[model samples]
Target: MPVEEHDPFEDQFASALRQAGGTFESHRLDLAARGETRGRKIRRRRAAIAGGVTGVALVGLGGALVLPGIQTDGGRRHSVAGSPSAPPTPAASPTRPSAMSADDVVRTLERLLPKGKFSGEEGRGTGEQLPPYARVVYDDGKGKAAVAVMVDRVRPGGSQALETTACPDKVFVPYDACTSGRLADGSTLMILQGYEYPDRRVDTKLWSAELVTPKGQHISVQEWNAPAEKGAPVSRSRPPLSPDQLKMLAGAAAWRSVADAIPADPRVPTAEPSRSQGVPGGSVSATLATLLPKGAEVVKKGVADPGFGYVVIDDGKGASMVQVNVQADMSGLANQLFGSGSRTLPDGTRVATHQGPGDKGGRGVVMWTVDTMRPDGRRVVISAFNSGTQHTPATREAPALTPKQMETIATSERWFSRD
Candidate 1:
């Protein structure tokens, strides 16, 4: 199913979350689900990477997952098992020489599987600019099921390592159960039982194993209830592999060897942020407090989120929430963002105002928003929610503030103080 892209403000918000480890339901726009009919997703939670839907193609930790230009990109790495020392080909080739060739990776997966009819194999050798992935259909006679393995690299140690295995905030990435642990070799691994749909609205079961070796190689294994990630009907009550099987597959030494062969970008010397790039959440909240209307009672606030912040307020009119985000250098997206419903100020600022249902679909919850950008492409967006959350019934008929009030906040000059 083709997902529509979100508005510019939302695009900035989602990008902030992705970059800062804050969580939001994937704008879902442009998410490639491969196959399936999708209605507007309700209670959607985001996967850490969006993983880009159908099957996650591994990119390293921190910043920029590829956008899909071709639909139906799957790693059908089907290579016949060959000797370990086979001569290699180009990086994009399904089979490339590594500690294990593409066929070696495929054969290793088959050997690891519990007895069954194995066919429809696919995998990539260590040679690709893209990560190496192995996929197979395994049938224990119940039905054909999909099992996949992807190997890449990650930053070793600290939050970056844990984030690779940590479950997403439940509010954004709902899952049944998840656990993280240390292997005997000191590697970090996490197993999660989740649904194909973020809301668990569907019965398609998805179970995954995420592991980061002490040396920073990342091996991710995902198994599904059907033969495909999306567009396929459930073939079983659960995926073919159990948690232990998944752990063994992702933790396989052979995948680590493949990861070792994959080249690293010489341009990026380290894996973590060189310095924090986001504004302190405290400053944002205090700044927002100054701009709020009188008679507002501040409820709670946090200072960890870099580029975004939120404040819940009450004025005896019931509880309403407000959020704002600031982004810089967005000039390139002007044409795609500023069109009808948008007007320009003499100062060369573009402003767009909108009133609509909350993005999360809280019952009777309305959202009043203002989006603005200076000619330099510095953007500010402010939105007011009628209810604390979209999933709940509204306490007020409309957002606490009017669109014009939000417009004032969004267009304020003080926001430029950050840059």
Candidate 2:
């Protein structure tokens, strides 16, 4: 019998060697045991196979699974999946930087800021709202400092809304404490004025700067700062707003800007609705007329479906039609999608199911979903339905379609004339 050689990494290679059978090559053993742990390696292989399956499905279905504008419970308001529905905007050019590194931005800001005998220290870069360009946060120790700065690229002109500090009880409608302005740079900056109640003292003033850098990129610097002493008089003194109340005001302003950016109609390039008709349609009436079962009350109306449109007619029993997206904002539709329980439609003919986050109906690459059922309880999933859980500025690529494309999507399927 030949003596067996002992390898230093034998234990690590043992499982793989056993699976490889009596004769194994040294290279094979090394390949299995090197770089990644055993479990990770297995998972990687599985993921690859899953990816291949997904690719096949996409090709077969003509990319319906990956539509743009899908909503999610997470901060994102739109789907990242490449869909033909919406194209992204062109990347704005990078602007000239005030400083190359975080340290530099901090140094420049410190030099520009007012100095005193206050205690404070500088901080590191969190991330660039834009790539390569970095954002640095600083604490002035006296509760005064610049929250962030954009050293490069400035976006061009647009009107921005500024709001005063007033927490509203009902957040659905617009609150009255804000104002909007168009900046000289064509980029609008909103200045939100703050005031103290009773005393009518100004608590702090905040503002956002939208600038179009020489290179055509857009950048906004948001900052706020409080008074020098407790109960001190607060006032708005100059341009480029102070960095006192940035943390409190940043969230609402950022998302509001994004909502403002979405066009009334995102589809164009074909025979759909004209530029004017695409604006968000009126609120969906939850009345009996619109809520009738697919074919019962009426038959043969066309509805918009994924990638194309289709028609359905109503039969007496219920309705015979493929479900399309119901046009209600994320709020009205969310409960129907993932509400705590189920509810019957206005017609009393259809009952729909609801599930929570991470549930089967709520899973997707870019957004969560909520599954609905027809009157008979058949499953139909509505993807990307979120009701204001959190928000981030929405970004778009080049326009996806023209007027012609929109018409094609809406009228592709026509229902037969009813008797």
Candidate 3:
């Protein structure tokens, strides 16, 4: 299960800001899709964050502040660091400051605001090759707000700089209040006040403040009540700074010389990649309750496998979830993951199927799948959902199983006798 080769946009913002391991082993089928155009795009454009580093290069690396001739609804402008693959100008050695000048980080963030009155500023200065931000729109009289800062880097002593301080992954982000710490010079700060839907459906709060720097920079400072962070509409109920002013604007030491002049992914890997193994969540819910199919009824279950799992059945006509995955050996990954409307079996086994239309938000819901494999690579996938959750909504209207009972439970042999 240490299956390698993956960087779907660094698993889309490392699974939209990861952190969860009180125990539940782990799970990741495209890390439960959070990107590929905002999760569950039904699997095609092959999430690699859409190739060659875009989203203006993860907004220079840690994302969330974003604002530099912004365009994207398919327009394109995003520039903030002289990019042409910016990254070859390093020679200084003294205690920092060879370059990076977003107007001295917008005058040290409008001279460390708090007496507030700031307004409409934009940022990006590290002599351009992009990755350093600072936005403004404060109002202190209480209403108009949105303050930003992004500066990036993180891989020094990696583990993504200790999970960028921690607290995310409430099964895919939905926050309310958070805090984290460490810093006597070792650096690590946190302070979340989440909601941009992890299933609040959308109350749109989004407060943030993450630090991390043991040399792998990653300062972030999100704010949102609406001025941006997705087609604005909330206006203001929270987000004017407080969580100790977002931990003093993410521990600002002037964003450590613009994260020491950002640049550190010269193709990363001084270490940090080897965690991915699955199957233990009660043996993946006892091998998906042995392929149920008689008046169903299972209630809710979860076990995002050593490979993946799920249940949530009901059969009396409402709730339906049914999910599963297995993946062993994988014959050098079947010609780039099954294509040309796959189909092979004559005992060689290959198959593929789909019914589709449930991309994460699950509106009217409906999905039914069956993907098999086995020339000696043993794979088996399955799906079904009229929904009991993929956030919510949709109680029925197809999918309690059937696509030939999900292709006989994805070509079963008891999922190859539980490996």
The lDDT for every candidate, in the order shown, is 0.58, 0.25, 0.56
The candidate with the higher TM-score, 2 or 3, is 3
Kindly list the per-residue Cα lDDT of model 2 for residues 1-419, writing each as its tens digit. Answer: 00001112222122222222222322221120021122122222111111111110011001112111223323212222344433343333343112123344345444444443222222222122111111222344444422333322212221111111112111111112443444344433332332211122333333343333222233334443433212434423422334333222332223232222322222211222221111133211111124333333333333222211112223333222222232212222233333345455554322333222311222121222223333332222222212211011111111112223222222221211111
After superposition on all C-alphas, the RMSD of every candidate to the true structure, in Å, is: 8.6, 22.1, 17.5
Scored by Cα lDDT, where does model 1 land?
0.58
- Where is model 1 more than 4 Å wrong at Cα? 1-101, 141-143, 158-162, 267-277, 280-303, 309-324, 332-336, 344-349, 354-369, 374-377, 382-402, 408-419
> Which candidate wins on lDDT?
1
Ranked by TM-score from best down, the candidates are 1, 3, 2
Per-residue alpha-carbon lDDT of candidate 3 for residues 1-419, written as tens digits (9 for 90 to 100): 11111222233233122211112112233222122121221011112112112231122111222212222222222342354444565654576566665556666777877787775666655544445566666777767766666666666666556656666433224456787878788888877787555445457676777787777677777676766544467778987888897787778777877778654434444556553333433354467777787889888665333455667788798987776666565555565456678788788888767676654443666666667778887666776767675555578888788777776776767665635
lDDT of 1 by residue, 1-419 (tens): 11111211211122122222322222221121110111112111122212222222211111234322112234453222342322344354344343445566677778877899887777655543244556777898988887767666666884445666765434234468888889999998888887766434457777888888888887777787887666678999988888888888888777787777765544333645432322433365567777888888887553444455567788888888777766665565565556787889989998877676664322566767677778987767676777654334577877778887887887777766654
Q: Comparing candidate 1 with candidate 3, which one achieves the higher TM-score?
A: 1
lDDT preference between candidates 1 and 3, better one = 1
Model 3's alpha-carbon lDDT is: 0.56
| Model 2: residues with Cα > 4 Å off, grouped in runs | 1-99, 116-146, 150-177, 194-216, 224-419
lDDT of 2 at 99: 19
lDDT of 2: 0.25
